[model samples]
Target: MTSRAIADIRGAENLDDLYRVFNENHLTAGWHKKRSSLWPEPRTSFQPLNWRYAEAAEAMDRAGAWMSTEDAERRNLLMFNPVDDNDYDTVRTLVCAYQMIKPGEYARTHRHTANAMRLILDAEDGVFTVVNGIKLPMRAGDVLLTPNWHWHSHYNEGAANAYWIDVLDVPLVHRLEPMFCENLPGGHQEVTSVPDPEACPFVFGLERMRAELEQAPARADGTRRHRLDIDAHIPTVAVTYIDMPAGGRMAEPRTTASRILAVLSGAGAAQVGERRFEWTRGDVFCVPSWHAFEVQSASPALLLEVSDEPTLSKLGFFIRDPAQPK
Candidate 1:
């Protein structure tokens, strides 16, 4: 530990001497000396995303008008958060995109390892997603889950284009190095008996869910909350519906889970740190991990919140510090 020893360690000329110095200094081989050169804290390059519904819908329409399902595959415009030009991620572990299917068009059958969900931005009859032979109608303000490795495809029988926000844990799955996807043999998956979209328990009906929660006991926190229990099907991601009454304010909450909130109805403002972001119906925004955030509703507001809570909880890293000071 003397200055002379430290100088000798730094001046080592041979591998054996270096190894001896490393051992004496309580260091191991490989990258230990390089660790200090990296960033001192975790840096998430992703930024908050807010794409207006009209803009998104128009872009999707243009794409749908020119591109066929066979040519464009999914007809999706992937959302890129502000970050390094080389990085294409909506968030650290998530990817969000706007997808559309035109009238009489279909998104071909395919499945992947990453868990996916869709929040209907504009709903219409005849626009349904077939997952593993089950047809679930996509309705406005409703959330549909296409769990990991499930064969799914979308079809638009309605006269208009179906628009939705598609979210997946792509970054997480890709980083884990087990990403796999396969396309079905035909343009779409085989359809079983046409089932009622309302009957599917996996679809979270926004108004219905809100009404049910209204009848239930209110939370001590003053927010009516209802979470879709799809852990048995989609284990990585979870979606919840939160309703805040007019003039209501939710105290800032901190959690380890990263959340994306879509305003289904009414208007509200979200405060993160010292910045406040106002949101109205059809707007989407993100809340990064461990950032204290509070929601204030100008009127009765409903939000569809998507997060990787189940994944973090399963990995033993999920923490909810509601008492944390902002």
Candidate 2:
């Protein structure tokens, strides 16, 4: 189309008029835009934000008093980004939420195409997640995975409430538009077996993870990290447990990967781009793509980090900023 025709199309007053002009001229709306699709750098609308577990715990207590498993599929509060009208995603390609289950309560069995996992923050004996007929006990510091399309349910048979952090690739699935979900025919599935912890491929038990972390050699900065491929069926996410000693500091180059970190234990401060988040046990935070970030521990800390690095790297979109001298 000519410049004048483009200008006319841009000036269309209504959606119907715009479509009419495009159809008449065999053009797309892309011609009306002045800005180039290609930009100099990565940009994102997601913000760097954090939520304190203390406040979430209080909210959970109030919710438990009024809400029940019968009322909803799960009792959880999302850590939604404070941007635009966004309510479903914590970041661009991932979402994290705090979930709680009261004693004797059961979250019904269901399965979806989106991969999911949980980081137990508070729980006692008798709390378990049954994934595909295997009942796996849930304890604080443990991580349990329920891959895409796997039947899963939660139950709290302990004396006190059970709390945990749930992270999923829901935003990615939503963007790709392959979402599918279904409730179990019955209310719950019968436990067919309880796999031994040593043989169970679906869990990273607390004690076992801790021992592995202790044995893993520390890097030059006195920090240790263990990587796990939590998504076995459809790999889209990666999980890492970082152990930082008191006074340890970690600085990483900016990368084109969105990430969420839940403070599993101890205290630390994170500087993401221009924002600072002081976090302790149970606190959660996000780092948007291409943001420079660093973490410093005031005390020895263990952190559970979830990121979309696998998806980006596999798609050949992953990149890291050039190294700079200190």
Candidate 3:
């Protein structure tokens, strides 16, 4: 690991002598390594996993019985990967959480270096998220952005509890060692303006997305996809909305991009590598990088997919099966 150690290890004469020198100098020889540094394909440490919405919702209900905004920052269940070392990440580069807010509760105001977004799973009319003083509505099937360092908080004024799927590039930030966070002086931020949901750049309403997907032609695999055009500023993540009709199936080509997908409507099943998952509305699942996947709609379904594709493409590390969609 050190230049001096490398220098000392190179002065040995024979194989045993070289290994002894390596041990003495605390060095490892590339030629004698037990494992190669490069591989023919990605071997991700994380595995494909799913977090059912029903289980999370039930947990949230139980938490709501005692936990409040005063007790925890967010009443949520983290979709942690079921890996030996991973405790917080849903995939290698992202962390997904199922968050719930009860009526008349606040999630407090804070911001971090991690870019984040939430897919509204079961929100009512009075649920809203305030980002940098702009209030945006949180309705079912809507996607709202809270980019890095933009102070944001959630509040529910509706009579019912609000639930949403939160996806963030926190694990990526944590790995990069540039993570930073801060809280507002007051727990809740003052809403300086309330923009029209139609014109607000931070809000992608369900109606508009559905309209666009309806007008788009289906792919050869019978799935219509719209690359949500809201990533002009957020560089780490790309969002896509896929619409599949009943019996429609998409055999996704293996790609070097890990993704977290949430079912926004109807029911579906997904095959990630050798694992299969049957999902309904609000269920979230992950597909690790380089895993072959297939999605089938038992009923007309809509999915919200979030991936690190933009980051990989920008870094020139992106690769996919030749059959991948354009």
Candidate 4:
């Protein structure tokens, strides 16, 4: 199409109009966000955070180490919503503080059963996330996942905090059982990703083991039971990350404890049954207990996930099936 025609298409008035012109495969929820200022009101419901996350983050940031409590009331938060928090009848969810740090700062390494994630918000040159000895490069909006139990740490090697969101399965796990933790035992585990001056073993330099696990899932029920993938070290849940390029779709997995997803950047659409929700950079979403879904992304997306892992770790049941497949 000509530039004029393309421009006109980009300026479509509504989703129907946009879809009519570009088709569902090309339509992005974030497309006309600028021109289409507002959209149908979103459902407002319970939203609360896992108190432990807030406490631990603050405590760590306070003494330049780590926090240890879960009471996250109002203090320095910019604009949060009880409706935006992770509020559930069974699982607890919270989007703790979004801290912006200065240069030359390093957060200590730790592990636990509750899964954790760091969504890079902003940063300059030299920001790095060290997970299991791999010091991966960090860029604004680039997401790095630390599968539960992995010894992970981060440093502002650049000149800023390299902001990120901490989404953990804390509340769900703690309620199910005691959350276990340890300080990597020997400080920060050293990574061997230097010599090449371009390799990222700790980031995405796998050859066999990881592939084997994914190929033949660690469990028969499509979910790993009380089996620890990383030897008998840190007890953590099975973790996954979705780097939805400009536009991508992911088939929801089968799980009982339900699941939660957070928008990392760009824009996207989430199909929960017949209803759809448009999301932005900081928008968060919770997939109901066993609600089959197909995540549609408009721009590059970085969404974090969490579930009742500890319960399953205790040899309890945590399985689910499509209520009524689509």
Candidate 5:
């Protein structure tokens, strides 16, 4: 056996010596493929960031390996819900999206700040978002908010890999220089909400929302969400859209943060404070910080909204005196 092994080892420098052949004589003299280089070589080109889905999928494969790791097995913080902890200073405010994947199931822990929210570009029946004492069901076109400094998390209780776009104020706060963070020292924060869809004041089913749209004339006039202030809307806070009928006017809301209105499937006018906007489907408009505006749906129209909800509660910032028109 020894003689045979010696015969096989003839002219062989051990494994390391053989390995050095590939290491030292790599494709250095060959064509330099800048495209595959870890660091940019002589030739580099720029591509739109949105055009990286394939590369992202490959990265996700490696990340999945880490997620299925033993470390993840013991600790369940991997899937930090977007509303519960999506804020990380550099993201969110720039209006970016991210993912939180976990191997096991269920991420149930909550603290204030680093909150999470989701826009369901795609959703699964088993994927549900539990936020601030309420479990709001998920669906496409649903604009959800995981309020600031609030406890929240998500669960993919379905068979397939559920996913959604996480939305938060991380970018805004990161720019502001205050990146607050904390963990539930004992455990998750108290479950202020249950998984009841009705628990949430505003319910948006495309058909239902369509039916509920109040008709305002189509002359030079307009329409709005409601004449009522948020406080008056109460526990059943209805986040609504306003349409401009005949004239150019709006019934504004009681608000503190600049409203973000994304026009969905319509052509219209949106005026905040004093500025007016000509908008269309896929167009985005904003109300300046702490100002109220009226919207005139140029034609028939629709929109999406996010607001200072529970965040206003902790700070005691949102309210209106019913005695006065807010």
Candidate 6:
């Protein structure tokens, strides 16, 4: 339209005139079709994170004293990504947090549509999670899964507090709009089997997993690789272990799935795009989708990695950039 025509539309004297002009242009005020382009270009945000153990532990101690399991249900501090404006999420599709259960405390029995997992950071034999009817002991460095809609509860029988990283696919479920949760009639679920520390296959199995990976064939560059434990029921998420030997480095790889990695042992430096992150034991960091990243160590280093690869693959949205620069 000409400048005069635009001016006339903008200077419409009455609502009827504006409505007539809008109708002539085939437009309505209901919703703008071009809003998507005018809004944020990328729906997802990516921010690198490094949570220190000392600070996290101190915060957990304070939270444990401030809240009771019965009052709060579970004492957890969500790891909010810096790039997120207000969402209490670690990544776009995942919610990662640290949870603390003090001795003599019990997390109420509950189940939800979102799948969940726990990577034990600090715990003793007496601290366990009862899923369905099986009691799975929570030990340091162990990964446990509480699949979707499985009744679960936590109890701490030890003298000290139990800590672990709690991860859930809540954001994804929320987007799908089918999230549902229910509390058990009783406060805690019944334990059908006796609490045994060795019942779960992946509990305290890090050493065995490492040894088995060592025996497997190595890459042409000689770095040991393995995709470790995965929840059979929740196939969309998985845990992997990688060992970087002294003076060895793994090439940066880029993929569609986001990855959250924890340093299980040793020290290393990670290159994520143009940024470099130095990490040691107990340190946690993340690599968002499509960002090329590499891990190198001056000494043997073990890393525990978690990702939503299965879900991406199932939806046929998974892609890996083999040409990503090292």
RMSD (Cα, Å) of model 4: 20.5
Write the residue-wise lDDT of candidate 4 on 1-326 in tens digits: 55865776788997677666654345546664437666442222433222222343454367433422113211123223344543323233323344444466565677766655555556788877677776777655444456667777666667544555554556556676867887765455686654332242223222222343355433221221121232232234343444555656766654544455555455777775455777766555656444556777777655555444544645765554545332
Query: Model 1 off-target regions past 4 Å?
Result: 1-32, 36-43, 321-326
Displacement of the residue 156 alpha carbon in candidate 6, Å:
1.1
Which 10-residue window in model 2 sums to the lowest lDDT? Answer: 26-35
Local distance difference test, each candidate: 0.80, 0.90, 0.90, 0.51, 0.46, 0.78
Whichever of 4 and 5 has more TM-score, that candidate is: 4
Native RMSD of candidate 3 (Å)? 2.5
Cα error, candidate 5, residue 171 (Å): 2.8
What's the count of clashing pairs in each model shown?
0, 0, 0, 13, 32, 0
What is candidate 3's lDDT per residue for 1-326, written digit by digit as tens? 57865676576567888787777766778889878999877788788888899999999999899889779998888999878877899999999999999999989999999999999989888999999999999988899999999999999999999999999999999999999999999788999999999898888889999999989998887889898776675889999999999999888788999999999998988999999989999999899999988999999999999999999999998899776664
Consecutive 10-residue window with the lowest summed lDDT within model 5: 42-51
TM-score of each: 0.84, 0.91, 0.93, 0.48, 0.43, 0.83
Question: Tens digits of per-residue lDDT for model 5 on 1-326?
Answer: 35644454464577644444434444232243335545321211211112122333345445666664233421211212134444322212334343434433555545444444454544567666666556666665554666566656666666654434443555555656677765555534455555445335433444444555554233334354531233422221224455444434555653443334545456766665555657665445544334456666656666655444444554675554233355
Off by over 4 Å in 5: 1-94, 98-104, 114-116, 185-195, 202-207, 213-326
Question: Which lDDT tens digits does candidate 2 get at residues 147-196?
Answer: 99999999999999999999999999999999999999987999999989
Worst 10 residues of 1 by lDDT: 40-49
Decide which is better by TM-score, 2 or 4.
2
**Highest TM-score model number:** 3
Candidate 4 Cα outliers beyond 4 Å, as residue runs: 1-99, 108-115, 130-136, 140-153, 180-255, 271-276, 292-323
Give the TM-score (vs. native) of candidate 6: 0.83
Alpha carbon deviation, residue 178, candidate 1 (Å): 1.2
Which pairs, if any, clash in model 1? none
186, model 2: CA deviation in Å? 2.4
